[model samples]
Every structure is written in C-alpha cells, then in structure tokens.
Target: MSARPAVRIVVVDDQEVVRAGFAALLDTQPDFTVVGTAADGGEAVLRCREQHPDVVLMDVRMPTMDGIEATRRIRAGADADAAPRILMLTTFDLDEHVYDALVAGAGGFLIKDVTAERLFDAVRVVAAGEALLAPSVTRRLIGEFTRLRPRPPAPELAELTPRETDVLRLVAEGLSNAEIAARLVVGEETVKTHVSRVLRRLGLRDRVQAVVVAYESGLVVPRSDVR
Candidate 1:
C-alpha cells in the first residue's frame, strides 16, 4: 500500500506575517505542503494558476480583490477537475459576507481564531472534495440569507428520492455522514452513497451548494418555528 500524497496548500493574506505564520505552521505537518503564499487576492489567483495546489487558505477582506470576487474568478476560470478547493478565513464580524463567499464557490469558511487542528482538518476535508459546512457557520449564515430572499424554484428537488431528500435535510442541519447514518438506522457508507446521489441529481458542486438548495427551496427554514 502507498501513502497518500501530501496535501499541497497556498496561503493568501494581505498581512505578510499572517501568511508566513500559516505557511510555516502548515509546512510542519507531514501530510501538508505549503506550496506558495500571496499577499492579496489577485496574487493568490496567479499563484494558484501556477502551483495548482490542492487547497487554498484565503482571507476574506483583502484590498484590491476581496476573497469573494477572487473566489468567483477562480471558479469561473478553472477547469472542473483543476479547480483548487478554497477555504475562506474570516473574522466573526465579517461573516455576513462569508455566505457570499460560499455562494461564490468557497469550499468553506473558518473563523480566523480557529484552533490549529480545526484549520488542518478543514483543509483536508475540502481537499477531499467535500464542502466543510459547520452548523454554526454554514447553517445559520445560509438560513439568514434564505430568509431575506424569496425562494428560488428548484425543480430538481423533485428528482430526489424520499430517502435522498431526507438525507439532504439532515446535511443542511449540519449532521456528519456517520451521524446521519445513525439517525436513519443505516450504514455510514449508505449515507455517503445517498449524499453522492443527491449532489449528482441536483448538479451541485458540493455539500455547501446542496445546503443552499435545501434552504432556498424551503426544505429548511431559518427559524425553528417555521419548520
């Protein structure tokens, strides 16, 4: 058996010290490689195009090109298989726009003060092609936006099996695969298969988008009283 390849990473921040600290810390991990660093969003995209790393740690509020616009540009430009997973780093007060970052194609967002373990796990999770949606961040932020906007028609919601629909609702609720499997009295792999089917049927890029659909289609409501 062969060991998995190290997860290559690029850190993007306008603050030189912040970028260096992240790059230095991540480089110390055996399973991670800090391939490059950038001082702003524009430079980040250029580095990504050159390094083609597995994941990027992107700061949300940089000058010239904010992370949201950079994310939109990256997703727009990269070929499907070549797109690097992006994890947006944000301060708590800035999360109002973090939701926009997600919709713009960020794989996930992490609070800037997150523990080292959580940060590393977030990168690995996204690099594995799964969107990292925390219940605190993904659910609340998405639900808030969905509440402010009118529901969009998601005819594809009709395509999901009853079981798959149930799975997606649970996902939107921030349950992990194992937790969903336990709740539904099934195997974890079964839950994974159902999630994959839901993503395929809906043409979603990842779980984050699936969550967006669940909210926008009214599968889940922002307030507990509503649903």
Candidate 2:
C-alpha cells in the first residue's frame, strides 16, 4: 500500500497563539501537515527553503520581516516546475499592502478571523492552483486597482469565446462553477472547462485574478439586483 500524499503547510505569524492554533488544526486533519512554523518574514523564508511546503499561511504584519517582502522573496525563488503559493492573512483595514501582494504573485488574501473550515478549504484550493477570492474581498481588490496607471494591457479578453465569456462574467458575479453550470443548463464539468479556458486565455493565475480583471475591465458591475 502507498502512503497518501500530504499537503505540506507552513504557518507564519508573529503571534505564537495564532501559529500554534493553526498548526494544531491542520495537524489534526489526515491529509494536511504542518511542515514548519515561523514567527516573522525572515524565518518564513528560511523555513520555506528548508521545508518546501506546498502552502504558507502568512500574516500581513510581523516584526523584522513582514509578510509582503517574505512573499516576494519566496515568489522570486519559484521555479517553473514548483512554487509554493502564499496565502496572506490580514485585517482588511491596515493591510493595504495586500494589493501589492496580489500583484506580486502571492496567491490570495484572507481575513484572519475566517473560519477553520474556510481555512482548510483555502489550503486545498490554493494547493490545487486556484485563487482564494472570497466575495467580500473581490470588491476590495477591484477598488484597489481603480485608476492605477500603467497597469498591464487589458488582458486578452478576446481569447474567450462568447460562452466562455458568459462563464467568466458569472464567476465575477460570485457564482460557483456548480451554480454557473445550473444556470447555463450544462454539466458541471463543462462549466469547469470553460472557467479553466477563461483563466488560461486571460493569463490569470486563478479565479481571484479573473474576478479582479473582470471588475477592473468593466466586465462585471455591482448591480443592486445581483447579490
């Protein structure tokens, strides 16, 4: 019999209690393993080099080295074959640096008080190469980019066919793949395929980036009727 592959994780936080709590929760799960814990950004980089974790739950604020710089250094070390996705945890107000983290190739951000289930789900999603774009954060991410100068060229919106465009728009509206499939009268797998293609076409890293692009490019607007 073969051993199951574990999802290696590193928890980086200045708070000892938070790090211990997260590590405890993850360690309790059968498939999730805590590879290491770091109290600050410099230690996070050292831990990453040693553990090569699949995901790092990084806090936005830390002493000596903050999460953003740590994320940048980690991403700079990413290879074509392997890269550890950094899931940043922050308080929405003070952590304006999250916008830079997003543009710097950090996978996504989560409010620190998010539920344990959501945290586990985020780990799985990011490990699977998806972005952890929550509905609440999507709007904020869009707001961050409004009127920014010299942004990358409007991502190749034309690459998506009409049906794919429909899927992308729906995703930007905070619809899940299952919901999209139900609305479009298609199999869930079909919706998933369309979403994958849309992300690929636009060179988006994941759903979060796709949603950001959709809002920034005016593909989806917050209507009173929707959500």
Candidate 3:
C-alpha cells in the first residue's frame, strides 16, 4: 500500500541515541510520521501541545520532567481528546513503574529493546483506541500497586449489578470480548454491550482501569493457588 496517512508520532527521551533511534524507526514505517522529538517530559508536553501528534513514545525517566508527570499534565490539559496516546518506553528487565504510567493516563508501554515490528504493533494498538491490558502485565501492575498503595474501597460496587460484577471478574482475568461471550454463553455483540455498560456504570476509561479497579477495590485478589 502506498504510504498511508501518517500516524503522527513524537519521540520523547532524554538520551539523544534513544530519541533518534525511535524517531528514525517510526519514520521508516509506511503509516507512521515523526512529527517531532523532545528530550524531556517538559518539552514533550510543550511539543505535544504544539504538534498534537497521534502517538507519543515517551521515556519513563527524564530530567526536568519524568514521563509520569508529563503524561498526567497532557491528560489533564484542555482538549485531552486531542492529546496523543502515550506509550511509555523502558527496559523490560527494569522495575518499570508501569502502574503509575497507566494511572497517569498513558495508553500503554513498550520495552526499549523491543523489535521494530513490536514497536509498530504497540503504537497501532494504542492509536486504535485500545489499552495494553495484557493479563500478565495487569497482574504485575496490580501486584506492585497492592504492595504500595492502600487498598482502595469499592465505591462503585453498589452501582454494579451482580451480573456486572461477574463481567468485571472475567475482565480482570483477561478474557477478551469473544472469550467473555463464550464463557457467558451470550452473543459477542451482547458481550460488547455488557462491556460498554460495565464501563459506563463504573465510570472507567477502559479495560485497563477496570482491571485495576477489580484489584485495588479488593474485588479480585492475587491467586494464592494458580490452576
């Protein structure tokens, strides 16, 4: 396919090599366009406001402004829907503070050593209005948050019907729409409707937040005995 309309992107990293590498890689893709680059979260926020890229490959740690704060500011700013989705970059082996990034309104994350295909795929996923709610990733994030933040109350429980609660449990277990449909013995479209209703009832941004709520609200606990 002739170069599709570019998914405008901004590379935000404190390190020159990282910034250049990301920008160059993304620019090489047919559908991706490198709109700008920034060396810190502060500049990233400013550039985002100015350029309004479709996606932002944000580094977790940077001088002047870290990815967490920049993401928060970008999410909180006027015209947040115009704000690009933030995909945090970090080493997979590192203790990446992913929970903070997600709560800060980042759409997802990518490890620095990821392959070009993986990077592009991640960008596409976030840009397509999907959250990176991988089961293992969500589990790790919930485990970390549970150890740090106080157990938040399930304030929305009263709003959720017993059926909604069941749907949420399946969501926290990482069941996709089809899987949920199959397990619930309902049509896929019906499951989708249920998912939408669940989100609206709980006032969640997306499935990722639903997973976090399931854990933090003590609705779902880490399994002491895995099957």
In candidate 2, what are the lDDT values of residues 1-227, reduced to their tens digit? Answer: 99869999999999999999989998988889999999999999999999999999999889999998998898884661277888998877335578667666677788888888988888997887666665555455555454352244365987779999899888877677878999999999999899889878887656766776776677766453322
lDDT for model 1, please: 0.85
Instruction: Show model 1 residue runs off by greater than 4 Å.
Output: 77-82, 223-227
lDDT of 2 at 20: 97
Per-candidate clashes, comma-separated:
0, 0, 0
lDDT of 3 by residue, 1-227 (tens): 67557798999999999899989989898888899999999999899889988899999888898999998898775443466888988775335466788777887777788899989898987787666665365566565576567576777777888877888888887787788889989898887787788888887666766877787777887664432
TM-score of each model, paired residue for residue: 0.88, 0.78, 0.86
Residue-wise lDDT of candidate 1 within 1-227, one digit each (tens)? 99999999999999998889889888888999999999889998899889989998999999999988888888885654579999998877336678888878888888888889988888888888777875465677788878787577699999999999999999998788988999999999999999989989998767787888898899977764422
Q: Best lDDT goes to which candidate?
A: 1
Model 2 CA deviation exceeding 4 Å by range: 1-3, 76-82, 93-95, 137-155, 223-227
| Stretches > 4 Å off in candidate 3 | 1-4, 77-82, 92-96, 223-227
Q: What's the distance in Å from true for residue 43, model 2?
A: 2.8
Least accurate 10 contiguous residues by lDDT in model 2: 144-153
Whose TM-score is higher: candidate 2's or candidate 3's? 3
Provide the lDDT at 166 for model 1. Answer: 99
Candidate 2 TM-score, C-alpha based: 0.78
Instruction: Judging by TM-score against the true structure, name the best candidate.
Output: 1
Q: How far is candidate 3 from the true structure (C-alpha RMSD, Å)?
A: 2.9
